[model samples]
Target: MLSKRRLTGTISNYRFYAQSLATASNSLLGELNDWETDGDLTTKIGKSLAAIITSLDALQHFKAEMKRSPLMPKRRNADAA
Candidate 1:
């Protein structure tokens, strides 16, 4: 089992990768528009990229909530006393 810090780091890394991929996807879409061809393919690829970005966003949010949860020992607030 990974430590809490390691787990959090892994999630953060994934979030960063997703963000980068989204930027690349947007760039590709822009190039497609400039070429003024294959609009249908561009739309399909755009939807796929959007879905990936949305999913990753949700995952990052869930990871944040997990870190804040009372059940996570490492994240427990000292002020809780």
Candidate 2:
């Protein structure tokens, strides 16, 4: 029974998290490329990539849930009244 505002806030938060995950994923990939010769560091970067992919999946699931929920109403003119 989440309120519209709460639901919207949840979606917004997830969106931010998704963006952060994407950024981290890109950074990790770059690091992996640079450290490919270092086996240990490259392995760690690969693990980080997997973690970020999982996070992105979770965020997408949250977004889908929000889309299925009947929370946000249709847009209305501010001065219609």
Tens-digit lDDT string for candidate 1 (1-81)? 456786678668767767766775776667666665655766666765776677667767767776666547784578997
Per-residue alpha-carbon lDDT of candidate 2 for residues 1-81, written as tens digits (9 for 90 to 100): 457887878878887878878887887877768784765786678777887888778787886776567774555789997
Q: Give the best candidate by lDDT.
A: 2
Q: What are the lDDT scores of the predictions, listed in order?
A: 0.68, 0.76
Worst 10 residues of 2 by lDDT: 66-75
- Give me the runs in candidate 1 sitting further than 4 Å from their true place: 1-39, 75-81
lDDT of 1 at 19: 72
- What TM-score does each of the candidates earn? 0.44, 0.61
Question: What lDDT score is found at residue 42 in candidate 1?
Answer: 66
